[model samples]
Target: MNITHRVSLLCAALPLLSGCALVVNAAPASTATAAPVFEQWRETQHRGGDDLMTAGLGLEGLRASVAPVFSSPALPTADEARRRAIWSSWRGIADLTPGGGFGDRYGSVQSAPGREFSAYARIPGARHPHRVLVQIPDNFDPARRCLVATASSGSRGIYGAIPVAGSWGLAHGCAVAFTDKGAGSDYYDLDAKSGFQADGTPATHGALAFVPEAGTAAHGVAFKHAHSGDNPEADWGRHLVQAVQFGLQALDRAYPQSAPFTSANTRTLGVGVSNGGGAVLRAAEIEGDWFDAMVAGEPNVSIAGAPPLYDFVTQAALLMPCALLAIDDLPQPPVQAQARPLWTQQCAALKANGLVQGDDTDAQAQSARQQLANAGLSDGALRAGAFSTGFDLWRAIAVTYASAYGGFAAGQHPCAYTFSAVGADGKPGAATPEARASWWSEASGIPPGSGVVLVDGNAAHVADDPLRGLRCLHALGTGDSAEAKRVRAGIAKAAANKPRAGLPIVVIHGIDDGLVPSSMTSDRYVPQARAAGAQIAYWRVTNAQHFDSLLAFPDYRKRYVPLLPYMFAAMDQVWAHLEDPTRGLPQDALIETTPRADAPLQPAQLSIPVVSSR
Candidate 1:
């Protein structure tokens, strides 16, 4: 399919549902009409609505003029200090550093026979007691070597996902070390603050803080359009670095207490999805020497890499209010130079395809003019008034204009833009057209990427939209056009700053992911790692979504277990090459297995545990 056609197909797949559900498959089915596993999966999804509510999602009844925003404070209280202390203590024991080389250490948690366990770590500046969740393996081994994994986010404590999976890892003779990043879960709370401020000032805790303008085009597009201000890329990157560093300290402690110390090699790899995937990149950058390899599943490396249509919509939101309403629009050059490439390419493509015309013959152009008429603007007015002021009004007006011209608002009515055929005539489809219409808004000044479509507020929430906008603007550093360049430059700088001399890093992203785009992985991360001469693997799954590809194993627990060996084995090979550069990238390190989490863990029972140290 063509780029626009492919883009439309991808957009159609982005349905928003709050909860996640898993479906397990039966051993064998002989029935003529056995339900597809995903069909069963949907049942679980339907039942999960309640869980989503508790997780603070999908409250459709609630209305807001704007989203809530926040900022991060220093690890404020003594209680916070106490928690850090606990984390530090556990980290110290898990350290596996070698021969007094503090930087070379790693961490591991192993279960002993009889459900007893030995936890080792190396905590820096040893000071306080820690509360750690140690999983004791039923079948512990002193003879077999182990593999260790560090989680990306510490906002949530170490007890959840990693611990559960690590438990299984221990059963198979691999030890695991998880880092809480001293934030200890509660990711939502931390992100909420970092995305905004308490008193409603823009905070410096988010990705936008690193950018120059400090709330310009990027944040504006994000807040007004997407209804989400979470900058998972930078937030997760920070957490990943902290986690890996702490995890290394934990690994160092594991040695000396155990055998052959420095000579013995146990593989280490970083893995995560979405934000977690972004974390893998951060960890690879900071803890390059610690791991043999890393896997990033569907991470968006640069904000600009997201689809262009979204950006245009956000631009419209910002420009419309200021130009048409005289509210002071963001300055010119649109977004940063980095953002311009994709937008330019797409715009050119659209124009070339005749979907968007450069002249008056353009249907979109004709509709746009009609939309202007509905918004109470005449040709003289269009020529006289600024475009930024009343941009949203103009957008609404445009839809009315389109309707008056027998066209429907892009998203609201399907019939207006609908047609049969797969070529340019109807090729991009209704969704793409909607995205384009939204892009018109983003092209102006509206928040293009914000996920919140509609919001409501009470008397107390009177400042809701403004406050939310302020927080988003501040958090994303999106006060003006200069800010857009700043955001893009920051990502480039971060990518440039890192040197890659150790380990193989492979980033895999699904093209259709609604949360994070695959382009970020392919465009920014792959290039950065490749420039450093790091062994880099960048894979794009055609139609995969966020984390759906990660946790979808058929038998989940049972089937995924076997792949652990192959994954770790790849790490071992990569580590060998890292230790000895003359050896080059390992040939056998590439192992293809099921890409989805739903694949079954095959060959159920095993009496032997194969442990390899290179």
Candidate 2:
């Protein structure tokens, strides 16, 4: 039997409502199913220098600032890139510091040797391929078959979920499947005219992971998410389902004794964070009986006509700096940026632009605060968002999403915001070949980091002032232009449909998650999910914000509980309920928690409760 055959081809939408309970197994895989998108795969083995979880970095090594070095920067072996990519991803998602739970408590820190298989999968009729990687842990037992399919958070590369879903699956001896969902840091350097291949080496010709159409690129870098010419976000869920199929097939290859691995013989789960979480939810809605359960943490879900992310992010980009100052005791204020006078500039700019009317900076801040609140953001979220705002993420996200939602080509970016390597002066320049070579390992999918910068072409005279570009992005969300219509149309396609009944779902989110704020996501979607009769369990943890790695900072540790531990805990709860109905899922309630402050996190601070679901 061919495992790819039963990959859950578009199920007939029964007139029933949203997501269901434990999914009953499907029929065995066969060739007579629908046509396949990922029937072929490339395989590799990771044992000594790198293993399944953390790439053999272990708890302490993962916390290290430095990653395994490439023997030659311009020509990294695929193995070298894989190891470093895992290292970067772990640091990106989890809080590996001594104070945060690296190994002592909740994290999946042990090394697990494995075989990996990858398929450059294309959605039907789509020209670009989303990269999918599936790891079959050496300890995977066909008799106790399980698979966890995850999508990468944000626009990060395939390894983006390494520390989140990857760790959990490998630790549980499950085949872990991951996809970049058509957006990754496997960048195409337009200047170099070469793009990184699946093997992590650059190629000027042939099928690269992402190569901007010839004569259709700006003089900088072009990443898949922003310039793929296809609105990939619309198909994030389909990519993940394909990833699950890829895993089942790879498992069959790894252990032929179990000739055809199917969902009937496996306990498959979908788990993701941020955008990954959104993808998991989308899959639950679209694919019937494909997954036994799902665990989503801080999903950046898009529901057209219901407070779109681009609108909020673009608005936050312009208003958050000034407005957050109105909130008292926000952690990590933009104090250092005072040298560039950013916060003051935002306040002054807002007042001058008629966006806010105030007699003083404080009054201007108050008006901006009121504007954001009126727009649907919670004060708690604004406080947490200030941290990311300080890091200048609001502008980066606004710039990236504007291109993605509009399907804007590399050269035709909204507001002429281009991505490229920049100098200390914040001026864009052709990236050095050496820098381009290491981008796959060093940079997150989004720019404004790892040598790549988001440069506003119009900000030549006033690099400190970002009003023009931001205003353009904001208008794309709220205005009525033809280009703006394109963005809105793309956004409409991203709105999630109801999940098929009987696939148990658990959504866990931090009340203070500013990156993908709950007020804009789970808070809005969960109620709708329940109203639609989806058997979903929602847990909103207090005192926890989005990013766990930020907890490494002393001030952050004192203010917020790490959301990862709770996410892992929720995964356990959902699994337990699936294994035995009597175990019951977690109650749909807010779980209280406390920050560790200066001390090590105690079990009591977590306040995780377990009881029969009511």
Candidate 3:
């Protein structure tokens, strides 16, 4: 069968083999009826009520259940004065200095029988302080050098690093370290009269701040200081790199005689997922000599690489409004009136412009084929499928856009433009007149009838037609303000993916990823990296979503839980290839894996036939 046909068949069987029910059931429970069986199982696990011992295995299950009851004794702590001196010794080091040379900066160090040494280091930066944790094996010896992996934490914060990759590094006899780059604590102190205010208050501590209103200077000030600011050099990515470097320094200082740690080797790797993944890739590109290999799963690398198509601010403006309307359970009449027309108009525009049409038409099928072809998925026999249909595209835009909006408007990082009419019961409700007026008046400057529409008050909200918003934002070009220009430049610099020559990098992404589209990697990063002469391997998993691995929901957990091992295995291969030139890394491969209830998950890999990119 041709590649197109193969892809179609894979797509058809995805729901069954890859657990489509999980995605279908991903939405919040609408009715009061108990959640699906899998969801219930997940809840049980969360509450510590599930009997793991009997659920999947026999003796092993019992051991798993009882294992946590036995607690290990705590290790001794290091002297506070000595720890301070150790860190003070390296106070003026440049942020990008590479390798392990300053481990003594760790404030606390304790060693267990098998776990060896676990230490925490606090590295202060201009914007915020970085907290890094390092783990060393009990058998660590100065004469025998070991691999060191600097892991980046995902969106949930620094605690997520060890579970994602650090534990695996430790098990493989590699020292593992991670830094919390102030994700949880980093914020602008709104009440601090000036940027230099020492109130120590976090940016997220109070009411949501305005983004960039013209007349409101307070809003602009908050926007400038918020975590996502106009300064690229001071952003989170820059801080992460510095933290990683500091963590490495602490490792070397702690083990000063350990082979005089110098260069990247099979023993030095960088690993992360999502935001963390992006950090890893950015660090590799900026500090090329620090790591021999890197593994980035669903890295957020397209903000700059893909240009107008994937910039975060543009995406928020274009997609979030429409998404908010679609998911609101009890939207007001005005909201529905505004949103429905916007959706219909955009769909009509798409059809009229030949961007989408009925799936049966030859022209439409060819168009669909061409688009997929760009992502290296065209097969002669494969016809334009559901995605090409105007109706399908409409539905997709609503669902995916809504999801994106929900994430963007989440309480953790609310923007001034993001407004939600959520009811006391935690469900979306109609907007009050006052709420509607607040946002509408502020947005009055938006061109009238230009896709951006205000629909309600008090609980009011804004809805932007997706396609129109995209075009409008693209035209805006990050606004005319100096700060806006800085923000744009910072994004471009941070998102650049120019890896140094000969570095082994493996990027793995799920084809169905909703948040950061998989094409960002398969179609953009891979080709760009190849063009740069970097030794890179790309793995495209059949059915996976952005939060699949991190969420405890049954379907998501099941589909992605088993894939971690394969990802690590791929990293190992990439590292090996860096060490041995003759060894080859797999490229354009399809990895299939099943989550096991009885044992550890394993993946079976297959080589995908090469196809020309459009």
- Report each candidate's C-alpha RMSD, comma-separated, in the order given: 22.5, 6.5, 18.9
| Candidate models: Cα lDDT each | 0.31, 0.80, 0.38
* Model 3 poorest ten-residue lDDT run: 38-47
Could you tell me every candidate's TM-score relative to the true structure? 0.39, 0.92, 0.51
Clash number for each model: 125, 8, 20
lDDT of 1 by residue, 506-548 (tens): 5554444333334434456676667778767655433233322
Q: Which stretches of candidate 1 lie over 4 Å from their true place?
A: 1-144, 152-168, 182-184, 187-256, 259-266, 303-477, 481-499, 549-614
For model 3, the local distance difference test gives 0.38
Clashing pairs in 2: 19-499, 20-501, 20-502, 20-503, 21-502, 21-503, 21-504, 285-499
lDDT of 2 by residue, 1-614 (tens): 23444332322122111111112233322321232445234677779877888777777777788888889877888888888888888888888887676566786778999888876767765557788889888898888889999999888889999887887888899899999998888788888788887677767886567777636446788888888877888888888887887777667667766757877778899999999999999888864467888889899897755878888898898898889768887776445446236787888887877888798988999999999889778888888888778888988888787788888888787688888887557678877777787888878888888889887777873555547777888999888999899898888988887777767788889898888888888888877777788888888999989889888888888999988887788888888887788888776878899899878888889887675763
The lDDT ranking, best first, is: 2, 3, 1
- Highest lDDT against the true fold, candidate: 2
Q: What lDDT tens digits, residue by residue, belong to model 3 across residues 438-471? A: 2211111111111112211222222333354344
Instruction: Report the CA-based lDDT of candidate 1 relative to the real structure.
Output: 0.31
Q: Model 3 segments beyond 4 Å from truth? A: 1-126, 151-154, 185-225, 228-244, 256-260, 264-266, 303-305, 308-486, 554-563, 575-583, 592-614
Task: Report the error of model 1 at residue 107, Å.
Answer: 22
